[model samples]
Target: MKNSEPIIKVDHLFYRYEKENVLEDISIEVPKGAFLGIVGPNGSGKSTLLKHLLGLLKIQQGKIQLFGTEIRSFKDWDRIGFVSQKANSFNTGFPATVYEVVLSGLTRKIGLFRFGSREDRKKVDHILESVGMLDFKNRNIGELSGGQQQRVFIARALVSEPDLLILDEPTVGVDAQNVNQFYDMLENLNKELHITLVLVTHDIGVISDKVTHVACLNKNLHFHGSTFEFNALKERDLSSIYGHDVQVITHHH
Candidate 1:
């Protein structure tokens, strides 16, 4: 039962910084419940296009609608949860506990004059449990390793219970072992929690294996389809997009 409705739609999207153009004539569509991955080289407008989806950058040439509604300030802003790569790049010495940081996402629906209600705290607990970070909840964020901190941020993102979750290089600072675990975690979120994931990353080796669909962007959008279609692309084509001799090992289910 494929639905024609889209969770995100971008038509003829473009963004310019003063005199320089970052994205040109870009168009993309993310259908409901799809795990979509964006891959491209550095300075190839990957993050810029992601900002458009988040509404961090305004549309200079086109329209973007999220969840069937136009990109408006009040309605669409809080509905999406963003976990950026910079979150890991942060100095861990920031004096907050992991529990405190994850609990912050509850601010979305929390009312005035109250930090977080009892129900909010309970919801935070549930999200932490889902992300398998319950025991680390009381630990200081700085004391934990990079992988643990990423899990905390993921818990924070899910605390809001968003229908759409956008991750910008979620595996940027982690080790290979943890990176696999991160993708596995996201795969669990997609299957068990059923959250629609849109991720911007340069690591095609990792995302190419996990995502349901791939969107290759290079100042202009190029390809959009199932990962199977991407797997069908020639090695030369893959190397061209990645700018390297890339190889992938996939398992048939």
Candidate 2:
């Protein structure tokens, strides 16, 4: 792919669930190394759009391209890492060490039945350290707090060395106090590791200072621009898109 090409491109996308339209004429481009946040009210089809990007949902109308290749023809699935809200649903009683959990991310590349190589183990350690979970390497996955577990999950995603990382409501179960740190970690991953990031979140205010761009979606894409442009939007404009009174809170670092 060329350096100027967007990592993800969606064009004239539309989706319907039986009778109602879930998404309408959605189009957006996520550039390489960009930290893009997708924000919308509940039932705004944010998750549906993510599913389309991940290839979990087949495209019914629009077209999606990943790594400059059309989604249907794209074969580099390993280049994209995904962390979902369901990461919090892990059984607390499940027995697995943090090290093992992170190491498992290499399963796709390592193939089944074969053990991780020493280099693979080192990669896991590096990823865990990057996510601030290396100290918990030997600890049980079920024993960590919500925020800590999320970090471990992120480590697992990073262990595969994906060029792009997508997170869907990753802070759902994390405490308020740790949310900032969690976002900071994500920002570091985007800036330092140079990994492109696409995050679906309800916390627009919290992520405003961190993300490079924002896409406001409510069935149709209401807005898509730099963080500065998103922040400049009037409350009434947001309210109109939300179909209810809305308030935008911006956090400044």
Candidate 3:
């Protein structure tokens, strides 16, 4: 691959679900080590787009490349880590400790029946420390708060040392007060850990302050640029993207 190749590239993408065109002529690029925040109103095809990136949905009328390889030919799935909204749906009653939960992330890599080696255990501990959940390693997964559980899940994803991390509405069940801290952790992952991040979230104001780039979508890709450029858009421009008047309140850190 060329040195300048983007980690993810979507070109002239189009998708339809039965009668509705869910995405139209969409295109975007995510460079390695960059933090990209995707913001859009509900039913704006954001999830559909993410599915394509994850290679879950077949590409119908567009091209998508991951790590410079076409999605159809990309086989290094382990290089990508995904944290979904379903994390909040995790069975809180499930009998598992935080360490076990994070270690499970390596099941695919280490074989389903094989136990983790000492090296693997150390890796898990390091990942937990990076995510600030090392102290809770012995705690029951069911005992943690939504925010803490999310951090554990992130550590689980990190255990495999993925180069790209994708999150879909990750803060769904987190308390309002802890949302900022959650985003702060994500920022550290992107900045300090140098993991490429593709985040789909509704927290536009908060995300705008953390992400290096922003993409505003509404079936079509309305905006894809630097955070500064996205923040400079007029309210009317943002309203047109959302199909209604909207306000973006930026929070300073």
Candidate 4:
């Protein structure tokens, strides 16, 4: 009952691969418990605007909607939860265990030829005890580390209880003290399971203060909003959204 709409509602977002223009005129909305935080730099388009908001790229000229439909009739793909960035390069000696890789994220909600019940192994043991990895479930997902296999692929993208998760660089190879305890377990799963985060990072000072919104792409949309108005901008507008010389340092724990 916490959805006050706008769980992502881009507009005018243009993408192009055949002739450059990765993402120009991109607009964003987010709302519904947003955590946002999508900085930029390396080739700008921030994973091509998160693969055009997870439809894996198609909307070539504009409008996206997601939780309010219209991402080409967004069929509620298990209410969205994607982890990507090679989601821990599997085939780890082909053995699989951390509770069969977080119960294989419920194979797209329990239907990969149907199996999971015991209430889907108690919802993959309560999402591997909310990503502490439930005491390493049964270990051996190639032995853990790399922040415990990225908290077992974020408990396999939160065992399908997704209400918009979408991570990309998720502390890419973790460890600067586990990337500050993996963004403090993604701010305790966005303030204790309210979800709706959209992180894509180049570590803008480790999500500045655990994000509350702050987009600043490069190919376009050079800044969005809040996180106290993107920390009152201008370190030369974050060094012109990372074309060079960015020196923002505001971490006061």
Q: Pick the candidate with the highest lDDT.
A: 3
The 0-to-1 C-alpha lDDT of every candidate, in the order given, reads 0.81, 0.91, 0.92, 0.81
**Cα TM-score per model:** 0.90, 0.96, 0.97, 0.34
Q: After superposition, how far is residue 155 of candidate 1 from its true place, in Å?
A: 0.9
- Name model 4 segments beyond 4 Å from true: 1-9, 12-37, 40-69, 76-80, 83-97, 107-137, 140-146, 158-165, 168-175, 180-198, 205-235, 239-253
Per-candidate RMSD vs. true structure? 2.6, 1.3, 1.2, 15.1
Candidate 4 per-residue lDDT, tens place, 25-111, comes to 899999987899998888888898888788878887889998788888888878888876553465657587888777888886676
Model 2 segments beyond 4 Å from truth? none
TM-score for candidate 4, please give it: 0.34
Backbone clashes in candidate 1 total: 0
Candidate order, TM-score descending: 3, 2, 1, 4
Encode model 3's per-residue lDDT on 1-253: one tens digit a residue: 6758999999999999998999999999999889999999999999999999999999999899999999999999999999997557889899989999999999997877566999999999999998889999999999999999999989988899999999999998999888888899999999899999999999889766899999999999999999999888898999999998888887666
Please report how far candidate 3 places residue 29 from its true position, in Å.
0.6
Q: Which residue pairs overlap in candidate 2's backbone? A: none
Return the TM-score for candidate 3, rounded to 2 decimals.
0.97
